[model samples]
Target chain A: MPEPEPIADFYAVVPAGGSGTRLWPVSRAASPKFLHDLTGSGRSLLQATVDRLVPLAGEDGVVLVTGAAHVDAAREQLGLADEALVAEPSPRDSMAAIGLAAAILQERHGDVVIGSFAADQVISGRDGFEQAVREAVVAARAGYVVTVGIAASRPSTAFGYVRSGAGLGVDGAPSALHAVGFTEKPDAATASAYLATGEYRWNAGMFVVRTSVLLDHLARLRPALHDGLRRIAASWDTGADARARVLADTWPGLEKIAIDHAIAEPVAAEGGVAVVPGVFGWDDVGDFNSLAALLPSVDGSGTKILGDTSAVIRVESAGSVLVPASGRTVAVLGLDDVVVVDTPDALLVTTRARAQQVKDIVAALRERGEDDLL
Target chain B: MPEPEPIADFYAVVPAGGSGTRLWPVSRAASPKFLHDLTGSGRSLLQATVDRLVPLAGEDGVVLVTGAAHVDAAREQLGLADEALVAEPSPRDSMAAIGLAAAILQERHGDVVIGSFAADQVISGRDGFEQAVREAVVAARAGYVVTVGIAASRPSTAFGYVRSGAGLGVDGAPSALHAVGFTEKPDAATASAYLATGEYRWNAGMFVVRTSVLLDHLARLRPALHDGLRRIAASWDTGADARARVLADTWPGLEKIAIDHAIAEPVAAEGGVAVVPGVFGWDDVGDFNSLAALLPSVDGSGTKILGDTSAVIRVESAGSVLVPASGRTVAVLGLDDVVVVDTPDALLVTTRARAQQVKDIVAALRERGEDDLL
Candidate 1:
């Protein structure tokens, strides 16, 4: 099996942000989810995301956009060239981060196709991912905003849905379809109905579009944000002093909005969005429950241990998710589908069914002003 | 309320020696359950046990018998005189621990009444407890092996039962009754049936007997153990060197048996054991669930915390038992009746219903050679 060739004139933009409060004690504001190796694969999620993208977008063509606070840690993990990393002065959400990267990629390489992939996602089946990215790139060249819609494996209410209308008869991208619209996370009944229709896929927030197309849409819809991003991108390569001066001036004021709400939803409404079916396995690693699904069961009873198995002792406990990160032994007895996350300064004990409510615990700690634990 | 006078010639014998495996991580072999303040009260179980007995048996009449390893800690907590503390060479079960105390007390004070109270039980209602002890002392003086039979509040399979026969009708002891027999912890249906008979009471392992009377029974039933205990007691007061030499020679060879099997059950068959109703609340603090019942509810949800309440945070969790002894924040979300015991070296997460299975966790850890955690 020969190594696949890199896509022509393509750049991968990884926006590494979000504190991921749902994964408290492990994912903290100081070192968010992207900096941690959630998959137990010996590579941080940011490194893994870049590793998956490097083959599609050549090693030199991949760029990382993260908070200024995280630049040193991100640099240590990814080892990307200084030019390939974009440090935001402050968080302006996905729009400002990805837009700045797209504008900079266009300035560096003439009007290339750029795809925005988050730094905190887990991906498997690289071949299928590459296939979807290649098709989305071809569709992007046809002047449409493209997103790789993940194959919906379950009626999950955790993610928004992208509705595919009809197939786009584009050359070299037969899997591309006209994206009709996007829907926010639906209730269980509504999600089941959407799945039953077979036209809906989980909007994985993967967007591949020509720099000109994305910038054009931004200019038309969000002029202030577009102007702010273009000014930052123009001075981004002209030494650290000029970049810092411009970022410090314009970054904080840029519209803090998710890319899905900024472009995908509006572009799909105007019949300018294309959906490419992604057959690869994908997970946002949203919470402990989602993490448990990705981990290999340690025993016959489906117990999942995220760290050293030797540090955990389970007796009559089945389907438990244990993270013994504190260097202390964790013992779970006669509890099924329980979640026990042990850290040095804090501990969380809940059930897998109530894993989502872990964020409530973080909220409570925050309410009590326990910032050190957060 | 007036303070009660001390019982004449009464000695409180506290035999403190169980590892309490079910309360592991907190109740370690190095620092067993008796050393811990399981209740939110400032005093430890051992200290509390001695406090209750001091009112009934006078300050100077209290004797603490514990393992040699715990002698310093017991001294620090109890402040008992050197002659009053009995340090065992090693664990030889309740029979050796209590019988040795009886023999030593008899050797020091001729034919005195000594009440053997375990050093790990929690008791409420001081008046009721003192009254029961007074009656049991009277019965013991009348040549009966007296045991305080706690009023069975529930059909608990965790404790053995004492069947009371007709009243002893002894002078100055109005509530003394003949203990017909003892039954081991029974099945649920059997326990319920025992409760229905109105004659059964929880055998709280409280034995009040004349030193001569108990020694006589020990000599007739198990002469070798009695002789070994008598030999150790004879040299116990004859300087540290003599005591150590005699203990090393005799302690290892003594029979390792519980007092119930050694004297109580067999003596009851011979119509010698007497039951004194203990209306005071009592618990052995055997496991986390039993400990929960002894604690006041922290919230309307019936949550119980054994350490710093501020160190714990609960959300949508009801009837949970939390022990945040690690000086770390413990957060439990959306789990009912769950048990989370966080210690510095180890953690235990289970449910209240499954609290008994915590011993299984200790066994598993022991099997895995994690003796430090145990």
Candidate 2:
């Protein structure tokens, strides 16, 4: 086999500034979800994502965009050189975080192919994942904002779907289908129908694009965010003040939209989208139940028990033994499909079906004047 | 009221020393149910019990009989004098523990009235409790094993009942008819019938008896334990050696039997047993459900929520919020009659019904080589 292309030029733009109440005790103002060592595997999701990106990006090209509040922590975790972090003043959506990263990356490395990935997802099949990413890089170089499509394993209503079109082979295209159209998450029935058709792919929020290319695309598609991003990039203090100024004055003005909605849908509707098919084991690590697939099961019940230490879990005089720790251990007693998480200030015991509502719990906490938890 | 009989002079014997798994994370092998600070009131049940007993026993006269492993912690909590502890070498049944306490008390202050109580129980009506102890003291001096009978409020299958005899004088003489006649824990229908009669009292396990009278009763009833206790007392090291010998030889031989079965039944069957009727707020605090009743209620639901600074006890997150340090703030998503205990080591999400089976969970953990949690 021929040697792989120069992977060191592959860069990563991680949007790490999503503020949420759902992952409270673990992910707070100072410690966001990406920085959380949820699996107790020494490295956090952000750290793990960096580690995963290392084979491609060589650490120098890795870019992390976070809220002003978590800039210091994000920097310490990624261990990057100056200009690696594109700190935002406030949390807009993925569109702003992604756009800001692209502008900064263009200034440093001239139009390098960048992989804009989330810091929270977990992917297996490392070789296949790497290969899929490499294919996206070639499509990106050919002037297409490339998106990876995961084959549907279940009728999951949590993600948007991408329907494939005819293969478009220009040059150096990896095993992939050409983009037909992208669908935002559908209702349960639509999701079930999509799963059965085999024409749908899970929208994984992963993309490969040229930095010069995404900036030009955004300038034409969403000009307000594009103009604000240009000015913030010009006034780069590389300090905390720059972050505060950008957040207080500019960030709140940007329309809160996912990149897929602001850019990918419009591009796909025009039939110029390139889809990278992935058979790799991938997980978004979306909720507590999703962790069951990423970590070792605590019991035979696909329950995951993860904590920094064992003292954090304690099962009473009953047959359960759970200690108290930041790690998570699910004890499936006579009851099944439950997730019990214990933190220092609060305790969460919820069913998997209601797991998505965990975010609502965080929202409720915020409304109740429990500022400390948030 | 009535000057409380200048605090009844007696040696108190507490027979509960074993670890209960139901209240797992808080309760441990070294620290069982009695030691956990469930109320967050800065005192444990053991501390509460000692505080309740000290005035009655003239401080130093109170004796505590507990398992050997807990002798140090029990001493730390009680601050009893050197001679106050009658530590068992191994765990024996209540029959042996009662006999042991009586033997030691008889040796120290001959013919003194002895009050046997449980360290883990909570009692209200302090003045009434003291008054009942005084009455029992009078009966004990009169050579009757005085059992303080709590008036049964509901037909509970958890406790044995003391059948009230024909009305007696303040002197506790068997003038009208017989003494206590039966020990019964009836079924629901049977218990309901018994409740309607108003002749039955919950066997509170609070017994007042002359040391010599109890020894005599034991000798006639359980001769082997009676003989074993007497011999162990004779060789007992009012020094450390006695404890060593008690643990080495006599302890394992003592039969594990409750006082109701071993001594009270025989005395009631024989003669001269006085049952002092009481309506005090006497609760065993048996499991989470009953234990919840003891705490200050929220929304009149008879539920409690103990959380750290970061937790928000929401409308839906009632019934359970045990924040055991570690600062892990738990968010109860959607639960009412559940206990969400978040420890740093483990997370327990359980209903009150299954809480009593917490030990089964501990057992399963141990079987799975999770002994460190136990």
Candidate 3:
């Protein structure tokens, strides 16, 4: 009935990256997936991410780590203070991004517990999300690197899987269990078999750990990268000149590694990782088909529209997804399970059955040297 | 081989109508099918029709019959003089449009043998078309209402069929034959059966007859419509004011009947009609499927584009008809036999198998009162 107050000493780190090549024209390199309102909720995914985090981390406790090119857009959309926006000079992948944020929090806020969430994910059921994050914070306080593993509703091969072992039997977290290991995206048969076992959950890449804990693990696992990130974090809050000098000197040399591989998997192998079951509905909106799944069906025919419903006209076309972003009328006839995304500069036509192949279109565009569209 | 000289006393009547709802977005009511270049041949279909006819009838001998709303575009595209353009106040179907043209040509040029060609049809093999028109004109001078019947290439259920009787043996027109009867668009089974007998040919509605003969037949078959057309024709050349007033008064009262019902079927039944075999390639460009059939394939995969080829990017889609009229990049992925039309104000997505049902989208648009899009 009522939302819980902000957790004390908890900070959120939103690492915004990825061009979403499968989503194509809607998610261009110039304006990526996190900046788009894929859910028709009137707020971009980045803003929605911050909105979800503010209840747990408080207004001033959330920091964003994004590319230097996107810092202005991130600040404009989130209305974050300069100190709260960490602009990466260039992409060194997730390990450097999340590690730098963790080290900087350790420097400025004295080893506060931090949770890393992606800026482009879609989640529903606020109570379940908050509850999962609360349990994750509890495990983090117990000195375990915690991950929020989403309930596997279907045998989907689009995401990695995290296996749960014995229950943690910890005090404040009843849903916490020992995370045995992590696996990359598997084949359909393997995913189905994984679903058959009740021990697997979708590894949504949500990690909550003390800033000092993550830094210490990074120092032992990837010492060079960890030392480089610590060097950049030392001057992050000093002055513009010193911060720019440190970022220019150290960020380029950091290792390009995902947090899952560098920290989650290795530390997970040592039995120091814990998993909290997240019953909330979640999606990364990786493709147009996934974005369609996030939208509410507009009619009894299962037609989904991301933009103005009145702009779409369907005849004998059931289960169609239409995004009319150019203020133009979209008419779909005699086609079932069709996807039509009509933007100003580009239009995409495909079927839901073959939606995963849309990345091929982007590749084709790239091969044709149509960089402006990409 | 050199081309033939213009035939003496031969005039051409071009009727440009039909919204082509099946080719929506590319063929809107404001700029119907004839105004579009469905073949990507630089010239609009109306211009191509006139280019084909100018050799049979002299450069100044072609008359265009179209709605008053489209007269300016037709004139600009055809480069025709004011007297060569016949603008109807409103649509009264094919009979009034063609009959009025006949009456006007009779008043101005005196009993000239005229051939009626739709402005939207695509034809190939110039020598074959010229030979067919030459034979039809000879039969028309012999006092027979003549029609050029396209050789049925397939058992297509999309068009009407004409049955040919015994040969006419008319001089200078060895290919002319007596017309038995005409059948409306039939079912697939009926069409196949009709093709099995070697007598049926596609009725393309290309009529060649002396103005006096057509008027006499119209008067005998439907006197009221003939009188109304004659009344409009008499004032058509009097003055602009008188022409407009007469059209407003008489055109609305004319019966809305197709030439087939009003003359061709009745004349054929009475053994007064003749058929000229058209062996050349021909298509009405009736829908996206037919349009695809007319375009040259951009690749061995059978993908067809009716606009700039560079504007379309196809991946794993075969036999797709794409019209990128909006100057936007259109990417189609993993769809076979799909039809995508991207225009400035509207878009259409469908499959070639369902191309005939595209008119249902127009109906849906009208039901939504989206007249601007239509």
Each model's DockQ score: 0.88, 0.34, 0.90
lDDT string, candidate 3, B262-358, tens digits: 9999998899999999999999989999998889989998988988999999888898888888999999988899889888998888889988899
Q: Which candidate is the best by DockQ?
A: 3
TM-score of 3: 0.98
Residue pair clashes in candidate 1: none
All candidates: TM-score of chain A: 0.99, 0.88, 0.99
Better candidate by TM-score, 2 or 3: 3
Candidate 2 structure quality by residue, lDDT tens digits, A181-300: 898779999999988887789978888888777888888899888888766665565656875676568767888888998888888887767889888877776777666556665544
> What C-alpha lDDT do the candidate models reach, one value each?
0.93, 0.72, 0.93
Model 1 ranges with Cα > 4 A deviation: none
Tens-place lDDT per residue, model 3, A33-146, is 899999999999999999999999999989999999999998889889998999988888999999999999999989789999999999999999999999999999999999
Cα lDDT of model 2 by residue, B182-243, tens digit:
65667888888878887888888888888888898888888988988887887665666765
Residue B148, model 2: lDDT of: 82
Off by over 4 Å in 3: none
For model 1, the chain A TM-score is 0.99
